[model samples]
Target chain A: MEKFKKNERVVALIKILSDNPNQVITLNRFSELLNAAKSTISEDISAARKIIECLALGEIETIPGALGGVKYKPILTLEQSLEFLKRLCTELKDPSRIIPGSFIYMSDVLGNADQVATIGRIFASCFKEKNADYIVTIETKGITPAIMTARAMNIPLVIARTGNRVTEGTTISVNYVSGSKKIQTMSVSKRSIKEGSKVILIDDFMKAGSTIKGLKDLMSEFKAEVVGTGVIMSTAEPDHKVIDDYVSLLILNDVDETSKTISIIPGIK
Target chain B: MEKFKKNERVVALIKILSDNPNQVITLNRFSELLNAAKSTISEDISAARKIIECLALGEIETIPGALGGVKYKPILTLEQSLEFLKRLCTELKDPSRIIPGSFIYMSDVLGNADQVATIGRIFASCFKEKNADYIVTIETKGITPAIMTARAMNIPLVIARTGNRVTEGTTISVNYVSGSKKIQTMSVSKRSIKEGSKVILIDDFMKAGSTIKGLKDLMSEFKAEVVGTGVIMSTAEPDHKVIDDYVSLLILNDVDETSKTISIIPGIK
Candidate 1:
């Protein structure tokens, strides 16, 4: 703790931001961290923000809320993030990667750069609003964005692991049916979250609501609140909760595997 | 394209690095970029390195090679990275995450902040070698590390998708078993990468060789070479590959579903 003086203020600010979870903070709140006057804290913050911004790190936004303050956009610019995703897509786009159904496989995209960067930035940005204390994602696809967002917000990222990891802690498993006409069970740990914390649910693709519902069932044990839900991409297939209020990077309306025709639509930027 | 100065020397230097992944770079090769006097280029490099180091962003390591040039440790310090990983694990270790047989799932650790920061530092360190052309990862779990790693390396991050999307020009899919015992297919598109790219692969977990093998197959199609492979965690499963060189944060030995005992081990620093 003693060695933290030089970086204390920044560290303190980071902790405050983390504790707020999906909420934005104004200059006034940051000023209260120290005995220094609001102006002095503001000056320090401006200098700190410059360093972070120049690095293409996080962002700072001013919200006109009733208790308006400068909110940190834990997310980065879309341009900055797209480059990372483009790279991943590029590699996966290789002719060698061609498969039978004309379906472009993307296990790597779920785990690669641009997709990861965009996921991180978006999650961070979404949580910049208050009331989001934790990030939740269905096993497999949803974990990527959930991780990125949780980390940016400096909060814990909880995963509803697809099934059971026999060697870990306690688990909460829920069974659900997929559109593919298969029933599956997803599980999560009982120790990875806090009671009453607001949770944001995320998924990679939402063809149905079963998986999201499974996550909701799991959260029930913790008595947590579902603050928001998001998806990276979505299809036109209906029958899901429609995600109370959601954000998506792209929308794939139709995929004709035979014609090799695919439609890609950018989400609300 | 016109914006990049045609520094044949710098280009050549980078190429040399790409060919030799994870190796240190000396000043002599840097001088070769400009065909300038060794002493002159040395000074320029020193200035350049100063700017880089001053940013507290990337590492510009200096090693005294046999040829008496500098060898940079482009990777992050083990201590810094370990600390961050521990913090992530601790946070992910929330008590509210307890599920019966499930664990505090960490599929998303790939893109979370502490992990991303640590991963960024680590990959940035690798880029200091000046050879990594691209960062690679299989879909889903690999995206987070690949994104942070690519960001740190300031290179493009490539992902292997699972299915083909029409938006992608051309794609190749390979069938392989993911860690979960599911024989799933992975995909990548054509024209995403050129031949002979030096790539660093990062993944969230490595329980089986299938996904990596699928990625390797995809890479082979593009004539791209795998320079390094990284993971956040690896399980000591009999089915796991032992010969492949990888960097991981933690190692899981056995997950006893009945006893609720999970044996954990730390990876090499």
Candidate 2:
């Protein structure tokens, strides 16, 4: 095998680390793949790490021990985060997005790949310290962001379905009242979650926080715990929420039907 | 502004291109970001591109024109694809995965981040030439693979819900027979897909191809054309399928309930 140059090695290392975020890659693997010595691989990693940190692209943590190596964790600077959110607020201000019942239409934004990935990285960074075993979300809109977060954190994604399906085999179901004050049933495959696991809950939008609370209740059925909760947007109404501890990226303040005006602000961290 | 070293520039270039696959990045933009001359930036991109191709990580296409600079596209070698499918077949061989009615319980595999991403890349490569405007899939199991493909293709994902929700605004619903020979209603938001657009349908599993057909029927309602369809697995029992043209990675041939045995193989391209 031919040895790779410093530039080529750096490029490959960045791609490998970025693709498998939060997962350790030993120096031996790099040395073997690039056909280089351990010392050369170490220098290459250091150079890549400095570039990542210097640009505030993300972080590379070096673990010290026999079972340790290096792992990448994606991060965005405060300025970058605020800039992205502000742009999101502006895009969401379109009155055409106002649907009936004061609901904002954000399917386009939530479905866009670039936007969803950026949001996922931001949410994953926030919950990285929680040591979550899984990232959980309800079916439909929340799956995209939840999947991205799961990829970023190198964890499994457990989706709570609205009902059971034949493909899911036996399932455990839970009932909770939705924001509309209607009782809804949410179910998950019996084998999806293991007992005593810590999970982070993510969703596209939050209103009365009923769905999130329902997830918490559902997690209890498996003896699992909800370590953290994150949402892209939450409404300002309902004064009091079903759950108090959660993080939201945007807050929907008011939507004026008469003038076709919408108001949005960044959510409190 | 400080100039970036070639090693740092190469790392950043790979990260940016990998993050935004299938999107073009102009030389001027890189020069501005790195605070270097266009010639220097061009050299960095060439180095990065060579490294990517040498490692079979992906491809960087440099279009020569006023509008084009470079675009990244992810690809997997045939050997890599076959190896991945072989491993997947082994994982699915466990008799415990066989549920009642000979259906396989694959929620665990579908929800897994790493496996889903690999499947997504394979599917995306298969359908990349279609230039799909949106990736469409039904709710629940298919969302993960669809989202990954959407991310890879740099497009939006439009999910068809099992039922309508207030959050989705007005929806167009269609009824079709599922593999269980039961009539099911699937709906998508009215604004999710634009008229005259091309879409690709993706799903986790197929039996009788009823769900894919349903998605096709649903897409026609919006005047959107279904250019391609892909799935992770399909059963071989259904010799005659609802959709004749589609790609599946794995084929489940037989499952003996009495002896607790299962048979699986790679699907024909």
Candidate 3:
């Protein structure tokens, strides 16, 4: 390999660190890869750290002592997060997004890479200190944000399915009444999670919080604990939610079908 | 904002480019954000480009003429890709992964963040030239890889569900035969995809190519063209396949029930 200058080394370092957010990269490894001394690597990291902080991209924390190194944690300021949610509210207010049953068409928003990345960063920032062993979510629409959050948090994603599949091995199933008062069964492969694991649940939308309650029940089967719950949007219709302690990015306050108007506000933590 | 040095600029530039891979970013935008002259921005980009090329991270191409700028395209050399697939094959060979009905339990692999990112990069590199308007996949298991690919390709992800949901306005449904000769129906929201668009189908696994066929059939209903297809794994049992043209990263050659041994190899493009 060719020798690299400090500028080149910094670029490569940023690439690697950003790609594996929340994971520590020891100084020894950087020194070995860049063919530089620990002091040189330290200087490079300091410069990179300063840039990241100045740009408000994220934060780089240094852990001292053996088995210690530096790690990057993505952050979204309150103002930035509020601005994003406001934009999301504007997008959701589109009358065409209104569907039967007063559901907003957010498939496009959920499927967008940029929007998903931003939302994931916000959720990951909120749950960064949970010491979560895994990021859990129900299958389908929630998978995108869950995957993004898992990536940001440097954890594995465990998806619970609506039903059992033959390929999933032995599965644990739990039945919970959905918001619509329908009894729905949710399943997770027994091998997916371990006992005594800490998990954070994420989802695209929460109506009556029935799905989240179902997930909590399913997690209990594996002896796992749901430390936190985050949702992209939650409706206001369900005055009584099954799960009270949770965080939502946006709150769907009201949707007037007759006038084709929808009201939304930033969620309160 | 304070003035940033070359090292800081390069780090920020790399972060922005890597986050939005395959998207052209104008020099003017960088200059404005960095509060630097176009010439200085160009110099910084040149240094960044050199570092990226030297490390074999990816390519930074500069487009000439009006409406032109720099675009980052992630690349994985054949050696790197083969190494990754080989490791994946080794992981899949675990005897305990063999489940009932001769299926392999790979939910863990699909749920893994690092592995999913690598697989997504390989798929994105393969289909980078397809000019796909959307990366499409079925709901559930395939969503992780599909979302990763969409992020890498800088495109929107479109997930087709097993059935229609009231939340998804009008949906188009298509029925296709499964590998076991059973009938299955798949549907996509009418608003999710536009007419006369190009799409690529992705999945976690393929058995007799039934699901890909279903996706292709579903795409036809919307007047969308299936530009390409990619899968993480495909079975060797099916002497004949439903889809003739598709790419698989790994091929499951055999899985012995009695001995609890499995055989796998990298699939040919």
- Give the winner by lDDT: 3
Model 1: per-residue Cα lDDT over A1-269, one tens digit each:
11222233443444344223335677676665444565665665554455445545555555665687665555656675555544544454454444454444554465454356457666566546665877888645565566667766666667666667653356677787764657888776665677888888877776556666677877887898887777776665563553446666555566565565555565545
Residues A224-252, model 2: lDDT tens digits? 98999999999899769989889999998
| Clashes by residue pair, model 2 | none
Residue A120 lDDT, candidate 1, scale 0-100: 62
Model 2 stretches with alpha carbons more than 4 Å out: none
* Rank list by lDDT: 3, 2, 1
Expressed as tens digits, the lDDT of each residue in B1-269 for candidate 2 is 77788899999989888888888999998888888898998898889989999998988989778887898987776677788999989989999988887788888887788888888888888887898899999987898998888988888999888878887899999999987788999999998899999999999889899989999999999999999999888889879998988998898899887888899998843
Q: Model 2: how far is B39 from its true place, Å?
A: 1.2
Model 1: how far residue A240 lies from native, Å? 7.5
Tens digits of per-residue lDDT for model 1 on B26-138? 66665554456676656544543443344332344456656666433335565656666666656555544334544435544543555565665665654455477877776
Pairs clashing within candidate 3: none
Ranked by lDDT, the better of candidates 1 and 3 is: 3
For residue A124, give model 2's deviation from the true position in Å. 0.6
